[model samples]
Target: MSWSDSFLVLVLALAVEAAFGYPGRLYTRIGHPVTWIGRLIKALDRSFNRETWSAGRRRAAGLLALLVLLAVTGLAARSMEFALAATGPIGFCAIAVLASSLLAQRSLHEHVAAVSTGLREHGIEGGRAAVSMIVGRNPQSLDEAGVSRAAIESLAENFSDGIVAPAFWLGIGGPTGAVLYKAANTADSMIGHRTPRHEAFGWAAARFDDLVNLPASRLTALLIVIAAALNRNASPRAALRALFRDARHHRSPNAGWPEAAMAGALGLRLAGPRIYGNVRVEDRWMGDGRADATAQDIDRALVLYRTACTLLFGLALTIPMLIWLIAS
Candidate 1:
């Protein structure tokens, strides 16, 4: 399929997700496959000791595993495509449904929205619980401001990692690309920490994830800036400036873009001192806005997220239609 056609598929998947939202608990149950995948990854991780394994060997092994996984996923998708071609419209619909399940647009939004609602209804405790699931941080001691910061940061960062990055890969390489990207991301999240146990063993997963996310992260920032402009609260110029100026402050090169853009657009600072597994790292802050964020800021960030998603979906759909029209 052409890039345009793949882009259309991504748009369709996003539309279906936005319109109906995910099935929530049912979707969570359906995530068993991913859970199993994670478990398999963990088992592999345990087999490779960080201190005992050389970085080059670990990278080689990770790449081999990735290739095998990609081949398997590709074969499965191609088989499904062939089966569906013979089965007519029902088969095609099934393919779409299956593909949509891999995209996390609805799930991402739902989780962030829950955080906002929790803060609104049940105060800091509720917000803490919601934030804890989405972020790696010490939530027990967070005040309202900290909770809002964590939730908004997660929403922005995950927009790139969880949603946009997957869509971009799916557009370029179909279901195989999407699945591989998710597996890489999942593996990184599972063992990509800088701690002694993961530093060497997870080097490949983390580095591969960074490479995969490079383009998508920048694209996410652009989309957010455009969305902010549409909303009239955030200037695209300022967003771009903030993205360039502050993105380097974060530890991860890719994550900084979206987070800094969101912070600039919303006029809030993010990424300060936070404990990771009891280690406190004095992280540089992004943006030049309020240090004390409120629940209202989280709501605004959600608005930006929704707008960006809509804008991105529209762009994806339009590209394919334009191409088809020109060809005709």
Candidate 2:
């Protein structure tokens, strides 16, 4: 298929996902792509990662394991594409449906919004329960405001990692590119950590995930800023300012950009010191706004998020048409 066709597929995929997220019945029956990738990563970790091995050896083994996972994932995606190419329009639709599974637009929104609902209806305990589903932080450590901030933080970071990153790769290399990214990202989430067990073995997955996420993170931040401009409740100037001023301070190289933009746009402070498990991590606050975020703030963040997603769809639709026009 042509490059334009591939981009069109991406646009269609995004629309499809936004309209109807992965069916609960379908997931119960076959599980999801990320789960499948997670299983592979788990096996590799068990087989290759050993306490007896030196850090250097474990690192090499981790890199090899990652290569194997990507190779397997890429081959399968390419084979599917090649087979689907023969069926014309039906195949295009099928490819789009499959590709849509890789994105988390609907799921991310639902999960984050649930936190707000929980906070409103059930209070602090309810908010903690809901936010725990999305974030890895210790739920008990959070009060109502912390719960709200955690939900917003998860929404901003996942906006870049879950939605934009996959779509960006899909536009670039079709299903194969997106699938490979999902695999790498899944690996990083499963194994990439600074803990004693994974610090050495997960180094490759961690680094590679960071490398792939670099472009999408920046793009997501810009998208958030533009979305803020369109949102009356949000401040575009502040969003842009926070993007420049505070994004660099967050621990993760890629996560800070979108988080800072979202924080500034909504006039809320985020990140700062937080507990993950028993560990209290000390980090710089993202925005210079109020740290006492409420459920209302989460609603505002959702508005900005939905608008940014719309902007992404517009770009996806426009860019391909522009390329075709230039070629013609």
lDDT of each: 0.80, 0.96
Model 2: per-residue Cα lDDT over 1-328, one tens digit each: 6678879989999999999999999999999999999998999999999989999999999999999999999999999998997898899899999999999999999999999999999999999999999999999999999999999999999999999999999999889999999999999999999989999999999999999999999999999999999989999999888889999999999999999999999999999999999999999999999999999999999999999999999999998999899999
Clashing pairs in 2: none
Output the worst ten-in-a-row residue range by lDDT, candidate 2: 1-10
Q: Lowest summed-lDDT stretch of 10 residues in model 1? A: 64-73
- Which is the leading candidate under lDDT? 2
Candidate 2 backbone clash number? 0
TM-score of 1: 0.91
* Cα lDDT over the full model 2: 0.96
lDDT of 2 at 72: 94
Sum up the clashes in candidate 1.
0
Write model 1 residue lDDT over 121-145, tens digit each, in one string: 9988999998888988888868999
Clashing pairs in 1: none
